[model samples]
Target: MEIKEHYSLKEHHTFKIPVQARYFAEARTADEILELSRHPAFRSQEKLVLGSGSNVFFTKNFEGLVIKIAIPGIEITKRQDGYAIIRAGAGVNWQELVDWSLQQNFAGLENLSMIPGTVGASPIQNIGAYGIELKDVCEGLEAMDLESGEIREFTAEECRFGYRNSIFKNELRGRYAILAVSLKVSDLSAPGVTYRPTASYGDLKTKLEAMDPKTLSPRLVSETVSEIRRTKLPNSTLLGNAGSFFKNPVLAEERAKQLIKEHPQVPWFKDSQGIKISAGWLIEQCGWKGKRVGNTGCYEKQALVIVNYGAATAKEILAFAYNVQSSVRETFGIELAPEVNII
Candidate 1:
C-alpha cells in the first residue's frame, strides 16, 4: 500500500467538498488493512475508514490517515430453504451489487437500486429506501478489529440496527473495518412494494400474479425501482448531493398528537417508539425548499436534499444545512439530525 500525504478529497466524496486528508492509503485486501493498522503513522493517529465517501461531509482537512477500502469480489452461495447467500467485498459499489442481483434473479435488494456508496458502508447505517433495508437481507459481516487486526464475523442481531444507525456507528465506532458482508436473498420470488413510490407506480399484486413462480425475473422489480428513484432524486452527475441530508425525526405519540391538533395535514408513520415525521414536509413547511445560500441550496425538487450548485464550500453547505435545521426546529419544535456523517 502506497500511503500518500496531503490527498485531495474533493472528488472522492459525492458532496464534492474541498478538503484534504493528511495521509491516505488504499487497502485492496484484508491483509493490506491489517498491515496498515500496524504502521506507526496510522497506529497513534485517528483513522477514518472510507468507502465510496458518498454519505459524508468533510468540513475541514483531516489530520489523520484516511484508509480507502478497495477490496472487491462477489460470490453467491447456496443456503437453506431455497435461499442464496451473497458475499460481497467492502469495496464493491452498492449499485453494482443491486444490478448483479437483478441479472442473477436474486430478489432482495431491488428497492435499494440507486443508492450511492460501497457495500462496506451499507450496514453502518442499515441503509433503507423504498420499502427495504440492508438489515432485512443482511446475514452477517466480516470485520477486522482496528486495534488487533483480527477478523470477526458479526450476525445481524449483533449489528443492532435502527433508523440510520448501527453498532459500527455507535458502540464499535472507529474500532472495526468492515471487510465483507454476507446477505441472504431469495431465489423464489417475493415482492415488497408497500413504500409510497412503488405503490403509486407498480401494481404489485398484479405483477406477482403474472410472473410464473418457477421462473420469475428480478429485473422486473429492479427496473421498477430504478425508474422511481431516477425520477425522485437528482442525478449526482448533474448536481452534487448525498441524497437526503437529515433523518425523518420520530416524535413521541403525544407530541405527534399535539402537532396534529395544530396542523391536521401533517403526515406520519407509526414506529416502535412513536410516529416518524417527514423531514421533507417539515422543511417545506418552513419554506426552505429551493432556498439558496451562496452556491449551496436546498434542491428545488427534494426538500431533504441539500445541493452544491457549482462551487459551494463544505462550510457553506453545512451552514445552509444548519439554517434548515434551525428553521425546521423553530417551526415544528422538532430537531432534525443529519443523516450524512459530517467529518
Candidate 2:
C-alpha cells in the first residue's frame, strides 16, 4: 500500500495518454485496500478503482487517488456433476484466464479470448465478442464496499448484466472494488457430455467450416478468435488505442426499417431492443475510415477504433471522436455514444 504523490499515468492507460494522478497506489490484497481506504488522503479524496486500464481514457489529469487493483490467483472452488466453479482474483489477466481454462478442458470462455483488461473489469463492462458474453459463464462475484470496507457477493442475476453494461458500471459505479469473480466453466472431459461451442458469429463460421465439429474444442475456438481479433484490431501497446471507441447503436424496429429503406446497404442484426446497427459501418459510410486528423485518426482496418498516431493529447482524440460522431449523426440521424470511459 505505498501511495505516491503526482504519479504519471502515461503507461497505465491503453491509450497512453499523458496524464497525472494526484495520488496513486496498488493493492494486492483486500486488507491492503482497506488500509489504503483508511488513509487520510484517501478518506477525503475521489478514488478510481482501476484494473489494467484498458477500457478507459484520460481527458485530463485525475484530481484524486487512483487505486490500481493488483489482487491475484485462480483456483477451482467447487465442482458440480459436469462443471466446475472457478474463482479468479481481480488482477488476473483476462486472456490468461481463458487460456488456462482451455488447457484445463473447460468449454466456456473461448470466444472471449484476447480481450484486454483484468478479470475485475470484465463484469462491469459485460465484455463480449463472437456471440459469447461474460454473463453467460459468470456465477457470482465478490467486491469490497469503498466506504464500509465490507466485502459483498453478488449473483449473476443481481449484477443486471446488459449489453456492455452492469450494475457495477451504473448503480454501483465508484462504490465497490471488485475482489474476485466466480465462473461456471464446463468440464469438457466429463463422460457422455459435450458443451455447445460458439462458432457462428462473424467470420467464425467460415473459419470453422473446414474443421471437424467433433474435434472442436475450447482451445481451437480460442485460437481462432484470437487470430480474428489480431487481424482486425491493432495491438493497444503498440498503437495506443482502446478498441471500438463507439457502441453499436440499437434502434426501434420502425426506425431501423426507415434507415434500411433510405440506405439499402446498411447492415444490422436483430436484438431484443429492435435492430442493432453496425457502428463501424456507419463510421465508414461517413468517410472517416483510414482518415487522419493531426495526431489522432481512425484505424484503417477497423473504422470503430480511434488510434493515437504519436503523442496525441486527450483533447485531440476527443475532438476527433466528436467529429466522427457528428458526421454519423448528420448523415444517418443516429447518435453514436462512446464505449471508452473518458476520465
Candidate 3:
C-alpha cells in the first residue's frame, strides 16, 4: 500500500501510452481500498480504478489518485447439481481465470479467451467476444462504494449488461470499486461454438467428441482458444495494442437493408435490437489496413486493431482512430465509438 507520486503508466496499459499518474497506490486488499476512500486527499480528488489497464488509453497525465488493484486469489466453492460457484479476486488476470475454470473442469468462459484486463473490470464493461459475454456466466459481484466505503452486492440483472456496457460504466460510473466476482460454471459441457472461428474448427459434437467425456479438461479448451486468438490478434509483447479499437456499429433494420443494397459483400449479424456491421470490414473497405502515420498504424491482418510500430504518442494514435471513425461515418453515415476508455 505504498503511495507514489508521478508514476509512469507506460507499463500499466496494453496500449503502452506514455502517461503519468499524479498519485498512485496499489490496493492488495479490500481494507486498503476502504482506508483510501476515507483519506482526505482521495476524498477531495477524483479516483481511477486500474486493473491490468488493457481496456484504457491514457491521453494525458492523471490529476487524481490511480488505484491499481493488485488483490489476488481464486476459490472454488459450493459444488452442487453439476455446477460450481467460483469466486475470484478483482485483481486476478482475466485470462488466468478462464484457464483456471478449464483446469477445474468447469465449462463457461472458454469462448472469451485471450481477452486482456483483470477479473474485476469484467463486470464493469460486461466484456464480450465470440458470441459470449461476462453476464452469461456471471452469478454476482461485490463492490465497495468509494464515497461511503460500504460493500454492496449486485445481481446479474442489476448490472444492466448490454454490448460492452454495464451499470459500472453508466449509472454507477465512478461511485464504486469492484472487489470480487462470483461465477457459476457447470460440469456438463455446454460449448458455445456458434462463432465463425469456433464453428470452422468443427461442429459442437465433433469438438466435444474429441475430448475425453469421462474426464473433463479445461486446458484443452483454453489451448484451442489461445491458438485461435493468437492467429487473429497482434501479440502485445511484439506490438503494442489493445485488441479492437472500436465497437461494431449497430444500424437500424431499414438502414442496414439500404446499406446491403450498396455493399453486397458487407457482413452483418442480427442482435435483439438491430443489425451489427463489422467494423473491421468497414475500415478495410475504407483502405485503412496497413496504413500508418509515423509509428502508429492499422494492423495489416486485422483492420480493427490499431498498433504502435515503435515510438507513438497517445495523441497520434487517437488522431488515427478519429480518421478511421470519420471515414466509416462518411461511408456509412454511422458513428463508431471507441471501445477503449480514453482518459
Candidate 4:
C-alpha cells in the first residue's frame, strides 16, 4: 500500500497520454486495497481502480488516488464432468491467461485470445472478440466494496452482462474493485473441439480452411486470431492507441433496414438488442481511413481504431474522434459511442 504523490501516468495507460495522478499506489491483495482505502490520503479523495490501463483514456490529469490493481495468481479450484473452474487474481494479464489455458488443454477462451488488459477488467466491459465474450465463460467473481471494505461475490447473472457492458460499468461503477475472477473452461482433448466441425465465425472459418490440418488445432484458432489482429490492429506498445475506439452502433431493425435501403452494401448482424452496424465501415466510408490530423489519426488498416502518431494530447484525440462521430451521424443518422473509457 505504498502511496506516491504527483505520479506520472504517461506509462500507465495504453495511449501513453502525459498526465499525472495526485496520488498513486499498487494493491497486490484485497487486504492491501482495504488498507489503502482507509489511509488518510485516499479516504477523502476520489479513487480510480486501474488494471493494465489498456481500455482507458485520460483527457486530463486525474486529481484523485489512482490505485493500480496488481493482485496475482491462477489456480484450478474445481473440476466437474468435462469442465474445470479456474480462479485468477485480478492482475493476471488477459492474453497470458489465454495462452496458459491452451497449454493446459483448456478450450472456450481461445476465441478471446490476443485481447489486452487484465482479468479483473474483462467483465467490466464484457470484453469480447471473434464470436465469444467474457460472460460466456465467466462463472463468478470476487470484489471488494470500496466504501465498506468488505469483499463480495457476484454470480454471472448478477453482473448483468450486455453487449460490451456490465453492472461494473453502470449500476456499480466505481463502487467496487474486482479482486479475482472465476472462469469455466473446457477440459477438452483439443482447443477447437467445441468450435468444430468448422470455426463459428466466417473470417475464422476461411482462415482455418486455408491452414494445414497439422496446424489446425485449438491453438490454431487462437494463433490465427492473433495473426489476423496483428495485421489489422496496431499494437499499443508500438503505436500509442486503444483498440476499437467506438462501439458498433446497434439500431432497431427497422432503422437498420432503412439505412440498408439507402446504402445497400452496409454490413450488419442481428443481435438480441437489435441490428449491429459496422462502425469501422462507417468511419472508412467517411474517408478517414489512413487519414492523419496532426499527431493523431485513424488507423488505415482498421478505421475503428484511433491512433497517436507521436505525442497526441487527449484533446487532440477527442477532437479527431468528434469529427468522425459527426460525419457518421450526418451520413448514417446513427450516433457512434466510444468503447474506450474516457476520464
Please name the candidate that would achieve the greatest lDDT relative to the true structure. 2
Q: Cα miss at 217, model 4 (Å)? A: 2.4
Write one digit per residue (lDDT tens) for candidate 1, span 1-343.
Answer: 7998999988788888778999999999999999989988678988999998889888899999999999999998665555789999999999999988877767788877779999999999999876578988999999999999999999999999888899999989989999999998876543432211233223343454565654445666667667667766788778888889999998888889999889888767676667888888899999988888889998887799999987999888978898999998888889999999989
Q: Give the per-residue lDDT of model 3 (tens digit) for 34-122.
A: 88888988789789999998888888899999999988999987777677799999999998998888777677787778888899999
| Residue-level lDDT tens digits of model 4 in 1-343 | 5788999998898998899999999999999999988887678899999998999999999999999999999999987677889999999999889998988888888888889999999999999887788998999999999999999999999999999999998989999999999999888753334434236665776888777766566688888888888889998888899889999999999999999899898878787899989999999999999999999999989999999987999999999999999999998778999999999
For all candidates in order, the CA lDDT equals 0.85, 0.91, 0.84, 0.90
Q: Could you tell which candidate, 1 or 3, scores higher by lDDT?
A: 1
TM-score of each: 0.91, 0.98, 0.91, 0.96
Arrange candidates by lDDT, highest first: which order? Answer: 2, 4, 1, 3
Identify the runs in model 2 with alpha carbons over 4 angstroms from their true place: none
Off by over 4 Å in 1: 189-217
Give the per-residue Cα lDDT of candidate 2 at 259: 92
Question: Model 4 Cα displacement at 341 (Å)?
Answer: 0.4
**Ranking 2 against 3 by TM-score, winner:** 2
Error of 4 at 100 (Å): 0.9
Worst lDDT 10-window in candidate 4: 189-198
* Candidates in order: C-alpha RMSD to true structure: 3.8, 1.1, 3.8, 2.0
